[model samples]
Each structure stands twice: as structure tokens, then as C-alpha cells.
Target: MWIPPPVRAPIGGAPASDRRRVCARIDRLVSGGQRQGWPWPLPPSGPLGVGRSRVRPGALSVGMRRRRPGEPLEPGNAHQTVPPLPRRAPRPSFYWSDFNNVAREVREFCEENGLVDERRLPSATELRFMPHPRPWLANGIRRHGGWKRVAERLGVRTATDVLSQPADASAPKLRRRGGPQKPRHYWREWKNLRSELTKFVCENSDSARYMPTVDELEAHNRYDLRYAIGLHGGFRLVARQLGLVARSSLIMRWTDLTAVAAEVRRVAERARLPPDVMPNERQLRQYGPRGLVDGIKQHGGLSVMAPRLGLRSQRHYPLRRKPRLFWTRDEADRQLKAFIQQCGRVPRVSDFLDAKRNDLLTALYRLGGLRSALERVCAEMDIAAVQRQDGVKT
Candidate 1:
């Protein structure tokens, strides 16, 4: 509040308030606010109010009074300088000079490391150690033409130079890292697998003990034979190699037709029919001609016997038409809708197939495509009941 008595002129001469207003206006004008027409609250009426004042144009109107005589300037006083503005980084350009420099550095690196004239190019691991601002040899080679052209331009030998030579050339071979690789099939393991299969066949050839159905094979704890068959070609070749039965026979064991013929003749003689004559197809389908049908049934079916006896299968017998075993279309759709309601979601085609209902597959396709049919079924299905049953929101 201690303004010099000269600055505090009472309401007429320049007061301290008028001096502050003038100084602020000058600062704004100097800082380029004049073009914006930013006006000062106090007009440029000089702090003197009427006469020409000592305040310089566009300068802060401070200390207009003359300094008293014989006062020395302070020692710590120094001129202030504005700090230099920071410079920006230069952007890169794809100029020939830059490309040439990149090429030269890469060529030198290749030559020094003995990679320039070799058949083998540097591995990714080796390339990682390339010097800074490396031009990344791989990227450079790809971008500036290719390896051959870049190398030719640089007067360096291309990687292809060594490769183009015959295999018998004097260039040393690239040794594999980590020593020799093991063979794919372990010889001892294969041998053991073959021995085990051979022993199994010899022991169980007469009995069907070792003959596994596809499902059984999948479920079995032993994977030896399966692995061997898969590793080698397949079942037939492996079985043939091991001197077992033919692959077809392995799938469905062949019947001894001569033994079957003897059994039929005995059954016929016991039934008091001519020893050579077999029962009619009708008789075979019925309670199976008493003893004969029951006996054949015991030994698989009359179908198996008919084949052995050099007769057509009784299965193909043109008897009275039986009722259709398959579900009708409406029945199938009903079942599907019922199932979807029960499960709370449409079932997959695989679900139908796995259900082993070939009829259902037929009916679904007949109604429409599987997805469309399921959509239709789902639309009709009682979703609310399904949700309630499943204890989840639909």
C-alpha cells in the first residue's frame, strides 16, 4: 500500500490505480492483443491526465521520477535472455543415398560375419545381433528389390550364388544343430507291438476273444495294436504282415460253411424232412421250423445259414408286408418337438444320427432342411414348460 507520494496523486494527477491500469494495457498491446481490438478499461489518457507525460509509448508506466544523484547500481543485476525453443526431429525419406548407405552397411556386416557368399542365409537368431540403424537386412532386402538384385547392386555375392552350384560342390554343408535326430518310428516298440499282436492271434485265432468291435477297440485300455496300425499303414497290411486273418474276416468273422452244411443236414434229419431238403423261407421266419429255426437263431440267424448252405438269405423272403417300423413324418416332427420341449433347446442332426433313428433323419429332411425343420418345430414347441422343467429362463 506504500505507493510513492508522486504515484498517489489525489483523483486528478496519476494515482497508483491509474498507473496499474496503464501498465496492464501496455502489456496486452505488446503481447499482440491490439489486432484483436482488446480495449483498456482506462483510456490512453496518460497518468498525468492532461499534459504530455514522461511515460514512453507502449511501455509499462513505472518509475517515471528521475533517480536521485550518486546512487550506485546493485551488483546482482544482470541482463535476462529468452531460452531457445526446442527443435523438432527430422522425418525420414526413402532416398537413394539412404538406400545405398543401408546396402553398404549390410554388405559389410555379411562379409565380416562370413555370410555373404554362403548357401545358407543368416537365421532369425543371427539377424537379431545386427548393428544399430541396421536397416534390418531382411526388411531392406525385401523393400529394395530382392536379395539377388540388392546383392548384385552392392557388388556382394548373392545367397543364391552358393545354392546354384551342384550339391557336390566344394562349399561345406550346413550341419544341423542339436546333433542327429531320432527316427519317427521306434524300431523296438514296433517290434514289441508286432510280437504282441502275433501272440494274440495265435492264442485266440479259433476263439473270438481278441476280436474287438470298433467301439470296443476305442474303449480298450491297450492302445498298442491301434497305435501300430495307425503308425504303419492300416489294419489289413499290419494283420497280413503279422500272419493273422484277412482284414475283412477280422471285421466279421467268417463262418465255416462246411460245418454249417453238416449242422443243417442233421437238423433236417431230426425233423424227419428229407436230409437234403431245407425248410421253406416261411418256415424259417416263423418259430423257425421248430428246432431248425431255434438252432439257426442260436448260431446267429437263418441269414447266416442260408449263405453257408448256398441258398438266398431268408431275410429277403417276400412274405406278407409287415407294418412300417419307421416313424411317419408327423410322428417324427411330434417326437422332435416333444424332445426340444423336454431339453429346452433344438437338437443337432448329430443328435438324431446318434439316436440311430435313420427314419428321423429321413423325416426331418422330408419336412424341410434340418435347420429349417428344427426352427419350425422349436416355434411350435412349448418353451414355457421347457423353461420351467429345466429351472432356467428361456
Candidate 2:
């Protein structure tokens, strides 16, 4: 290394050993112990020691960063800015004015479209095209009850109000949304339904009280009448209100004993029994509907009704009681074994019910419970082994 004149002059006149030692000290001071064969200079031999790079501190880094010893550490650059959180959506404020605005919009829409009735009024989902805010309307509907209630409060016709009207007023059908509205059911009114029913009966049966059944209406293609009847109550209720009688119940006028007696005699003869001699009640049941038995009972009884039909009434005999079977444990086990054999295994209560073995069932119930009674029977008869051999669970 070529030393500067001023720096080398001091060592030039010294001894060889002295000059060599001075040059070594100058090299170490300039290099600061930096290693060779490296792109950048190595750091000095202490913690937080700056690297002895030829490049100046401010020049190597882009900024004028300088730190003195013993200062508090700070976070990354304060110059960086982050976008603030998006502003919160404003909470809805419910007001009657908002509700009324939506209602008026609906009303105007209905009027322009010739919707004079409540049944065909547009629902909330269908009101999207209106100018009023939908959220406010939804919240208002919830707060004030429901959509139907809100519509009613706003004086807009609703389905409940429209149902009781006698006839749906005909509106000029237009090609509107939801396919030209529901094909208006014209006879929705109570008075109109009754009159139509009366007219139908008079034309078909020529009897004012002959109320038509649902099947008759369906056969003649009067679906509207059936629907109206269901809405009011049902076929029976409507018939009762109009003083009408279905053909099924027309012959149910069992209050007249003379007519009832004649019917009974007719039924008895049909059953191949002698009509002159009063038939037993069991004989009449085979050839007649249940209503016949009910009617006879209503009039008085077979004894009273028989004489009126010119049939000689049979002598009434007092029924004698049969001997009651005392259900012993041995008797119960025998009956249960027989029942299990017939059923091919243990049976449920319904099996006893079906087999008409109420006495055994009563006795089983009289014992602790069915489980213990069954266990006692199985133990006494060795039935569990038999059941196991028979491939049935005991």
C-alpha cells in the first residue's frame, strides 16, 4: 500500500521492525478487522457495532435514519396509512309515514290495474317495483302484526274481508303479472251459495229439502259450489243451515213411529223372515243398514214398533246370567299355553283382543302385570324351553 507522505514520513526514518509494526497498526485501523472475499464489509467485534463499509451511512440506506445509543425502540414507519373501516350502515327508523307511503303506492298500483278486491292484492314479494323502501315496509309489517294486518290497517282490502262478500265483482281481465290474476270465483257470497244450491236441487230432485252431496256436485261439474261449501263449514253444516237434507239422511225421519214400523216390516220380509210374525233383532241386522236398527231404537223398541206394523210381537224373556269362571293360576297357565300354541308363539294384547278372550285378559291384568303373569305361566309349564325349541323368543 502506498502511504501518504505525511503518514509514511514518521515511519520512513525508523528501524525495520518499528516501521513494520506501525504499518500493521494502520492497516488494522483502516480495515476495522473486515474480512476479504466478501461483497460487504464485516461488522466490528461488539454488539450493535456498525459495519466498516466504505459507503456512508445515509448513502447506503434511502432515508436520513440515525439512532443514538440508549434510545427507546419505536414501531415501523408512521408514514404508512391504512384505509379506515367502511362506515356502518344506518339503522332503520320505523315511522307511520314510511308505512303509509308504501301502502299508498300499493293502492295506486291496484287502482291503475283495476284490482278492486283484496284477494288479488299484490303481496310483499310482488311489491319490489314500488318506489318506497322495501326494508322499512318489511320492518313496519313485522312491528304492526303481519302483512295482512298492515294491509287491513292501511284500509287496503284483504282476503278475510273479501271472503264474506256474496259475489266477486267482475273486473275487466288484463294481461297483467301473475298471469291475468286468479280466475275470479264468482259465487263466494253466502246468499249466492245458498241460492245456487237451492236452484240445483229444485232442477234435479224437485224437492226443496233435497240437498246435493259433494259427489253429486262433482258429477255435475259444480266445483265452485263444493269449494264454497267447504269454506262456510262443510256439506253437513250447509245442509243443516238451509233446512235441507242429504238423500242419505232424508229417510232418517225416524220420529214418525208409523213410517218406522213399516220400514222395519219391509226389512224383515226382505230378510226372508215372516213379516206377520215379528222377527228377532239379529235377523233384521243381516238385511238392513245400521240406520234401520238406530231408527227402531229411536221410535221406542222392536216390541213397540212390531205391533204397529201388524206383526205379532214376540214374548219378552228376562236374560239369565251365565256362571262366571273363576280364573285360578292353574287355569290361567292352561289358557295361556293354549293361546301361545294357537298363535305359534307369545302373543300381544291385540291377539287376546282379536281372539275374544277377555276373561283371560282380565285375569292376567288382575295378576301383578302381564310380564310377571307371563313369566309365572312360562315357569309353571316349562313353556320357555318349548318356545326355544320352536325357534320363538320366550
In lDDT terms, how accurate is model 1?
Answer: 0.48
Q: What lDDT does each candidate get? A: 0.48, 0.56
lDDT of 1 by residue, 1-394 (tens): 1113333223235666766675565445435544655232223434334343533331324312322223222223233222233332343666333677556657565565656555344332344533322335556555665555565666655433433432322334333332121233432466866766666555545543343333334444345456656677766666566565443422242245454456565555555665445655454444232344445554656545665676553244443332465556677778777666655565665565666655666666766656665655656763322222221112
Q: By TM-score, how accurate is candidate 1?
A: 0.20
Which residue pairs collide in model 1, if any? none
Candidate 2 deviant stretches above 4 angstroms: 1-191, 198-227, 239-259, 314-394
**Span of ten consecutive residues with least summed lDDT in model 2:** 172-181
Off by over 4 Å in 1: 1-92, 95-98, 114-125, 129-135, 155-157, 160-325, 329-394
Judged by lDDT against the true structure, how good is candidate 2?
0.56
TM per prediction: 0.20, 0.27
Which prediction has the highest lDDT against the true structure? 2
lDDT of 2 by residue, 147-239 (tens): 566666776654333333212133222221211112234356788788878888888755667688665776677777778889889878888
State in Å the error of residue 48, model 1.
Answer: 74
Q: What are the RMSDs of all candidates, in order?
A: 32.4, 31.8
